[model samples]
Target: MSDDRRLKVLSAIVTDYVRTREPVGSRALVERYRLGVSPATIRNDMATLEDEGYIHQPHTSAGRVPTEKGYRRFVDEVARIKPLSAPERAAINALLSGAVDLEQVVARTVRALAQLTGQLAVVEYPSLRRTTLRHLELVALGPTRLLMVIITDTGRVEQRTVGLSGRGPDGLVDPAVLERLRLRLNTALVGRRAVEVVPVLAALAEQAPADERAVLAAVTDELIAALRPDAEERIVVAGTANLARSLDFTAIGTLLDAVEEQVVLLRLFTSEDAAHRDDADDTGTTVRIGSEIHEDALAEASVVSAAYGPGDAVAHLGVIGPTRMDYPATMAAVRAVARYLSRFLTGTEGSTPG
Candidate 1:
């Protein structure tokens, strides 16, 4: 048979095996799919495919299943990621249309991606290092107590409280004093990165009161902790429950352990330094199957991922499912939801939070 015929036969076998979760035999392939070939001819083709190391036989009585290489070829060549159907698109829009803030959008996006794909979903929020300072708040707890709160442009909240050197009544340090302090802090740091707050702290010491000065110093320390690169803010995962029903125990155990090792997940999503790479398209999603995934735990699994952001700073969203996952449908759902999340995060396409 020609190579074209062999590939068609291979496609049929893979599609059938995926749908049924069973090994495929040439006889069954000929009987089920309209491949325009006899069972003997397909058997010969299957032999060739297996010789090429694309498919494997699990047991003496069983038929052939697609190997990791086979799944990769099918995903890259035979599979076409279908666009979201009208109803599916409408449902996603309806679910996300009422989001009140970035947090709501992130939560809804993860849940919707999970429900649509029937897989575990992972969504990474914007790294604090990538966000700009939007606003600052300071409240006096007493003559000796103060509270500092910092809000980032990407909507992350950071706060700290400090006890000052001198004692006085809390009510005496009113909103006016707080506002004055806020103005001074913002004047030096507004629209700059969260990582840049420390130097500004040193500058404020010359102008602030000894008591208020101590409070601001504490505020700077808190901001640095919040925005540090390794902060525990890389990824949020949902739909672990979905994994229970679909994946076998061995595979689930490996995947669960991998998830607990956040470093592994971070390396999977971001580059070595955990910075978003330039080559990754903000609009397009990446899909890795079987051996294409770096870790052994994911060898039998497939991952679909996308990045979102404003300029250089971005976050990642991804789905993990069995290698037999419905590729075209899952890819479409993941792509659409990732696009919606990009819009929600950057305010480029969706309504602003009320």
Candidate 2:
């Protein structure tokens, strides 16, 4: 069969099946798509496509639907990614316009993606490991209590309160003393990894007088806990209501719980290191179709994800939706949101969540 004719038939079947969520028969193809071919010729092409594993039928009497291979080809060759419509652009603008900070902006962006695509939306927080320290604040809350506040280059702020058994001289260790400690810590840790701060913990402890040694130890422990990676990758998800409203309700019902959704999302974003080639530090957007992720539950799901940060810092942002989702529109929305979020996290804009 001619390649041109095969493409036309493939396009017809994909378009029809996507619209009706039903199989495409030769008669339906000829009637609707009108490829200027007799039923017999189209049947022959269908047979070839089925033999090539690009299309499949539920049974002998059923029509054909595009297989995963067929869908991949369609995504690569046929689908045209386009920007949101004027009304949609306005809605997105309105939704994101009032975000007071990066956290709110990211939450709003996730909601917008889900609303626009009618699928589950996920947006990952910027990874803390890739961010440098913007500020380190030490507050002496009480005789035996201390508070360590860590501000990252991405404008993420984390504070941990530490309690010590031994009390220090209260009036002698006021805001001025705390600021002196903060300046020393920041000088040593400003551009380094949070983990790298471990070596200096001992030094900071020695800097304090004997009476305040215990208090210093407590603050160091709190700072370490706040900087850990497990505390960093926490994701925010929204618009799960769209999943409940899907026409394929039964197929997704068992997986609609928050725990299950989080698991599915983590698996989708964690790429095998082998798959990443040049510039391992670069942030990016990726889309995966059915069966590509090697999971049965997600076989019918399409994932649109992105990594956001400084060019050297890698982090993820994006959404997951049904395979029949508006691919072009969803892709455009995901890409745009991811780009904007990267800017927000990097402090290019004067916005950070409250």
Per residue, candidate 2 scores C-alpha lDDT tens digits across 1-354 of: 248898889888988887888889999998998798899999999999999988999788899988878877777666666765777767667767767666788778888777777778887665566567878888777766677787887767676787766553544355555666667778888877766777877777767766556556777777777766655356778877777766643567655753255776665555522233431222244567777766667767777665666665456766766676666677777766666666666555333211
lDDT of each: 0.74, 0.70
Among all windows of 10 consecutive residues in model 2, the one with the lowest summed lDDT is: 272-281
The lowest-lDDT stretch of 10 consecutive residues in candidate 1 is 272-281
Candidate 1: tens digits of C-alpha lDDT, residues 1-354: 239888888788789987898899988897898988778888898999999988999998899998878877777678777777777887788778888777787888888888888898988877777778888878877665677777777676666676555333553555555676678888888888855666777778777975466456666666677777766665778888877787433568777888777666777775522322432334365678767677787877888776666665357788988887787788778778877776766776463211
TM-scores for every predicted model:
0.83, 0.82
The collision pairs in model 2 are: 101-352, 101-353, 102-353
Off by over 4 Å in 2: 1-4, 31-39, 170-174, 199-213, 258-261, 270-283, 346-354
| Model 1 alpha-carbon drift over 4 Å, by segment | 1-4, 36-38, 142-145, 162-177, 195-212, 247-249, 257-283, 296-299, 348-354
